[model samples]
Target: MGTFSDPTFRDLMAQRPFLRLWAARLAGTSANQMLMVALGWQMYDLTGSAWDLGLIGLYQFVPALTLTLWAGHVVDRHHRGRIVAACLATQCIAAIVLMAASRGHWASRELLLGMSLVFGSVRAFQMTAQQALTPLLVPMNLLQRAMAFSAAGTQVAIIGGPALGGLVFVFGADKVYGLGAALLAVSCILILLLRYTYVALPREPASLATVLAGVRFIWQHKVVLGAVSLDLFAVLLGGAVALLPMFARDILHVGPEGLGLLRAAPAVGAVIVSVVLSRWPLRQHVGRTLLIAVALFGLCMVVFGLSTSFLMSLLALGVSGGADMVNVVIRQTLVQMETPDTMRGRVGAVNSVFIGASNQLGEFESGATAALLGPVGSVVAGGIGTILVAISWRHLFPALAKRDGLQAR
Candidate 1:
């Protein structure tokens, strides 16, 4: 294990281009997190309806699902940094418009939903471009460390963005939106300033085969298939984020400020784990570690669902975040190491879909189930489901369960 002052850590930090990319990612993610906090809180405030809050997630997922594959093709063909920058620019515009609408007293559930659609569309490209671009910035040997470090940055944003948004909400949702817009603009500028090695590949014509290539590749590679699909099902069932507003207001009796703490709890755990992983770089029993981490995440969710005490709930969520960070670092490193650079964008797009489904669509699922089962029942049931999925994957993908390391053998 390496210390904070380790030579490798310093080498990664000293790479100017990667540093710029990391800065841009940190800022952009922070903006996105703030935007989501405002949107979710505002939507609940407007309707006091779980379904409507869930609808915000559904709206975002729809465009991401529809466009991500096509976006992957574009990512492969175009300059990845510019694509990321363009996505940030679009989100900044959306934030500005949302701020205007809020201040103008014209922001409605419909307007929020519309902007969510725009966010979903832009994220499809942004995620693919960013994932593909990372390998180009640093040495392949450092890729795993780079991912862990990047995750550390993302976790910081996740923790601070919501807390900041919640604090800013005291002023108005408009203030939160305005601040998010500014962060996004700064992220866009940083991306524009980034430089990396780019080799233009021969342009390939658009075809169904090309678009579906990432999907086919995953299916053919069972290890990759197992890794991505494990996340899809586990997170799909275990995700409790959509119901957070209800928890904050109705169950926990914690206002938006408390909601911020709830939102930040997971990232608190995630950042700590990410920093550890960045130093140590898991080198053994990675597959078993992945499964154990997921099962632990499910257990935390169960604890969270049953807890009435705010402190207990936060503890459960924070622990769950740590477990999830472990899962993320392993899965991302595994997928990227196994893939060729040419297909990274497409594969990353597919990976993004699984992520989107687990997050955004999972929100929709949580809302619908909460409507039927109440939030407590829905969450408890989902937690158990997540545990079962992990166990089932262990049996179904034995190769993944027996796997040993991040690097392909």
Candidate 2:
């Protein structure tokens, strides 16, 4: 296990600007996770309908999808730090509004849905700005390690946030919202404190061509296109997260608490692997490593689908998370390193769309397949599909497959 005293950790921590950026991301992500839990619980409490709960996600997704391209354009042309801080501030305001509504007994389904829209909109820009800013904060050689560290922080937040929210719920949802607001406020301050030299690109007029430049860039770069698409199809087919509830209740017979453990399994694995990677990093044959990691992820999912034992299932999910962390670190480092600074925001924007699509659409795909083939069959088939996709990509995108390093040639 790597410790804070490790030279690698010490080197990364020495990058003061990236440290602040990483801390800000950790705080902001934790707040976002808490907000999602509170929103879901409160919305269900109000409407008592699963469909309404589904609508909340839809409300968020629709706005993010519609605005993400423009968000990229804005990120490239403006101050990324200020943009991130502003997004956090917007989220802070939303949390405060939720807190007031909950305490005043005026919280309603419409109000929650509206706030979801605000979150989704702000996230489109925030995500774009953050991605574009990371490369600017650290030296190129340390970028992968920095990304790994960032992933570790994000995984920790994802694991702890909901658990913290659940604990705070004993006091009431308003308290949860209040806590989320405080966290967002802190994140906003940290981002504002961030220092970087921003090279202002020539402002291009907003046009269909300018807005769609990100899409065009991805389409043109075969290696980037393959990496991005690999994630999309792999997770879209292989993801079992949506069926976790069914597994906990029916297959595992562990109920709600077991469900929480199952959900945390992947994140736990991810965090461990992230820490290791931050220290060691990937030195060579990174493309093949990425492919192998995806394949391993699929195999883990296959084991998880077939296993009847809770411990086995947890083990499978944990390994899958580790595999995913490997994939994430490589792909992110590759994309950011390969793209020029002027285009990183746009490329990152397109990359964000791919990620968002894979997650949201992956869940929908899982649920639909589960309805038809049952959960086990759905997961097994998806895992098999993912493996096949990885194998096919080795041939389909030779540039990506043959690529040997995270650094751009």
Candidate 3:
């Protein structure tokens, strides 16, 4: 019942601290979007090899996967706001170095990848802390709206960041890097402006046991485990993004412009859905809704795979994006609502790893399957696999399937 036109949305937005946090998310995510574009172009410019282009993802993934547990541990035991600020500061420094490297022609492939590694490392901490901090800023009733609005910001960034990066890159690589640094600096300032305070968990001595606790907690919580793993496997098996280029170039024969549209289609869909969700939140059947959305995502993937027509393909991808946004809001809300503050950092870390796995590993899966089955067959097979995963999850995780809403029990 919370439309943007309604007082609920306006009331939530009017809160000073929450608005500040929202601004920080927008600024930081936009910078992330710009950074990805610039980094990819720089990598390809340095080495024409597509393999190295692929390694940029790998470089980022390795640190996020490896450091996530420790990052969560630090988040719980420390001031989350300070931790986020420090991470942003580190990223600011990295951006400056990258800008200098580009301007001085001091950049090597190794140096670029190393910077990518550093950026990834810092991002793990920043995201974990930020996720944990969000609940602290908004009251329970407004959390769902807050997340939807937050998601809209990300979709906007995803849609615009590449275009912005490309425009700045036209001027100079350093200028692109400078823009990223400046945005990150602004994000850091906004986070500092947030009046929300952190209530840190009691300090505990570092131990292997402490680091592993998040994994254990998730394992024991059936709903959380089910929600997280559902996304993991569904995305892993359903991932058809890596095959889009093949579809655009070979099947659709749309070339570069068509490819750009195809890539943007999902984000466009996501933006629309996110805006709508922020206005008209899903207040009932949260678990079932999530499952339905993901299953539709799988079906859309199949439709996309089979389509030779460009418009049809775009429509299918758009629908898939819309469905995925639903999954994102539902899954994120479930995780946040179910988690205790003491465990939020660890749970967030677990969620982050699942996300990284689904994205990075999913790409690899798509590419390998495409090579084995041809792009169409590979995508179709992945879609089928995703549907199967959804079906199995419904039966396997009945708790998640039966759950009614996002309100904490």
Candidate 4:
């Protein structure tokens, strides 16, 4: 029914789908990371304010939420590979538009925001298809490991892409966008190479009715609702990583390069842990383990907030990233395993909304709170809130602590 986890790197390489998907994810995410940094830097350079930098993240997310549900319905019902390919293709077009704007030629902020809206729309589609499709590409026993591998790829983009982006931006952001477009175009090509349609379950077909059924199903499932709630709260409260530029420049005096490193630190730690997970996979007591990991993640955020030393701050953020990976693997497994096969795409869409709210909203929260409480206080308070969420969630889902990974038939 499944493959063994304890395999050589060569054995892991034998899985063609895994290898292709891995490469595609890496290339796509690298471009995504580079675009994020380039866009933020360009906006900040143009406006010369931390709040403006925050708005860049905000603007991208606001429009994305509007399309998430429809994207999910389409993903669940349609050919995922084609959908993903289309999304990547759309993203490439958006990147080209961004490149034009990077020439410092746009007369109005509305133009930039419009491009961002389109980019976010494509991403909303891409994410829904990608999340739901991954489980189908690998065995149930290997779901967490596969997820861990995907997480590691994201880490590479998150950690390494910025360093590369910093160099590119030092020269010109237009060049960065150009490279990002190239990368995404290449990812679309690779995605076309995958036969994802073969893996999806053939159902009675998808419709608005089926999509609504998925939402009602989620509403009825207490465990899922609770887990989603916990994650949303903890992440929304504790995500201070978005404010790293301010910490690096104003507080620690590292400039852009240092800001890039600070931004990359968490990904570095996540990569280290994720590599281990690819080999070891998640074992028993998965739920309790996730709770503990989230608690530790919260503590690391608190430590990062209090630290003035750049290295110490980086280390703290790294620990948070590492711990958060455990939660990611477990939660994703829970979603994939417990969810009915036909509705995976819709569920993935719901999860994406929570993720967007937590991440993008958290960026806004950091900016607004920083204006009031100062950056350090805002981060520290967020960590405390995350810890409280972990404790509360643990009290609510005692059985989750006793569960184990799924076994496919």
Would you list the C-alpha lDDT of every candidate in the order shown? 0.90, 0.93, 0.89, 0.79
- Superposed Cα deviation of residue 228, candidate 4 (Å): 2.4
Relative to the true structure, candidate 2 reaches a TM of 0.98
User: All candidates' TM-scores?
Assistant: 0.88, 0.98, 0.97, 0.87
lDDT of 1 by residue, 1-409 (tens): 4377878778888888888999999999988989999999999988899999988877887888899999888898888999999999999999999999999999898999999999988998998999998888988777888999999998888778877888898999999999999999999999999887788877799799999999999999998999999999878899999899988888889998799789889988999899998887888889999999999999998998998899999999999999999999999998988998889999999999889767866787899999999999889999999899899989999989999977755
- Candidate 4 yields a Cα-based lDDT of 0.79
| Per-residue lDDT of 198 in model 3 | 62
Alpha carbon lDDT of residue 394, candidate 3? 88
lDDT string, candidate 4, 192-212, tens digits: 998643544555655677666
**Which candidate should be chosen as best, given lDDT against the real structure?**
2
Give the local distance difference test score of model 3. 0.89
Which runs in model 2 stand beyond 4 Å of their true positions?
Answer: 1-8
Is candidate 1 or 4 superior in TM-score? 1
Q: How close is candidate 4 to the true structure, as a TM-score?
A: 0.87
Error (Å) of candidate 4 at residue 39 is 3.6
- Estimate, for each residue in 258-366, the C-alpha lDDT of model 3 and write its tens digit: 9999999999999889888878888888888888888899999999999999999999999999999999888888899999989999899989999988898899899
RMSD per model, one decimal: 3.1, 1.3, 1.5, 3.7
Instruction: Tell me the tens digit of each residue's lDDT in model 2 across 1-409.
Output: 4356677668788999999999999999999999999999999999999999998899989889888988988888889999999999999999999999999999999999999999999999999999989999999988999999999999999999988998898899999999999999999999999988988888888788988898898898999999999999988999999999999999999988899899999999999999999988998898899999999999999999999999999999999999999999999999999899988888898999999989999999999999999999999999999999999999999999988878876
Error of 2 at 8 (Å): 4.5
